[model samples]
Target: MSSPRPVWTGLVTVVLAVAPALAACSPEAAPPARADAPVIVPGAPGQSGSGPARSPAEAGPVAADVRFAEAMIPHHRQALEMAGLAAARTGDPLVTAVADRVADGQRPEIAVMESWLRSLGRTPPPAHDHGTGDHGMSGYGMASEEDLTRLRTARGRAFDTLFLTLMIRHHEGAVGMAAQELRRGRDRAMRAMAQDVVSGQQIEIARMRGIQRRLASP
Candidate 1:
């Protein structure tokens, strides 16, 4: 009643001074201060805050992304070899045109995929090691050795027909790999490449299918 303001101020001052003493006396009075830097949990890398921080891609690509590009390189290699044969082996202008376009489009894509693998510190599969059986490629419409032999030996319209047939199957394999990457890959650039593979080869598939029908008709 007389002057509570001074009393209140004094009381606040006392509490402010005494608070640290109280906290120091009792271990449970207050929790410890948090760290400025990230806390690292032990037992495993990247478990929570373990190890140094990393960029998005530095966490490493999922198996699907790496495998997709690795498998596709030789996949495209086989396609390029087949495309190279069209000019000398086939008489149809349409087949030759498609071969030229496929080689043009895929050469850059192979370079891109190879660069991507190198960026990830991965070794891209060698062109020759990508056997038809590797990475379940047999399931993805890969051409057999016999298939290539028949195509290599085919002449004129026979070559055109076989080339289109094999090209369509090969494109189907690429589309299948791209679709798997779209489903399971985490890397954005690789996923974009996968999407391109899917879209581009689907278009080729349609074109080859149309050509196949035309060639079959009387």
Candidate 2:
């Protein structure tokens, strides 16, 4: 009988020899994504406001008011990014419309908040990254690179379903952030914005949940 050890060694050698060739024959892979995984969008840095700064005492009843606004500007911006993905990438008209509204509504607010921050003589919290800050105000629930990958890969109804679901969660976090501002904010302008966030996002949240349900039905 042939020695089992020799037979095993031969099989191992053949498998090793085939592996590199198999890898070469596979489909071409895309370049690795960044750790932060920002989507590639071409644009100049937005125009900055030269508005006057507000005193710390002028901000709100508690530190939470200022903190909420400071944290939320970036959170809202992230939500806008997800909305942009739906608008530019997805095929669903419903998704595109919702995304368009989100993008349009938030852009003006970004400017408003930037103006508010400038008035305070403080730079707007870096809108890009917020690695866990005070009072658990985590900007917003940012979708992971994996989430973006899945969104990019999905199409048609599947893409709409994923976008709506992720957006619902993202909006819910915004509601929380806005509520904190409403509760503690002293600035009338800032409080007004927070109230708008709560009202607008709540309506949109209902709309998103409806979309999710419709997509789920047979």
Using lDDT as the measure, which candidate wins?
A: 1
Question: What TM-score against the true fold does each predicted structure earn?
Answer: 0.71, 0.65
Give each prediction's root-mean-square deviation over alpha carbons.
Answer: 22.6, 24.0
lDDT of 2: 0.61
For residue 97, model 2's alpha carbon misses the true position, in angstroms, by 0.6
In angstroms, give how far residue 159 of model 2 lies from its true place: 1.4
User: Local error of candidate 1 at 215, Å?
Assistant: 1.0
**Candidate 1 — which pairs collide?**
none
Question: What is candidate 1's lDDT per residue for 95-157, written digit by digit as tens?
Answer: 887898788878777777776665545567776654455555767777888888898899898
Global lDDT of each candidate: 0.68, 0.61
Compared with the true structure, the alpha-carbon lDDT of candidate 1 equals: 0.68
For model 1, what is the alpha-carbon lDDT of residue 41?
Answer: 20
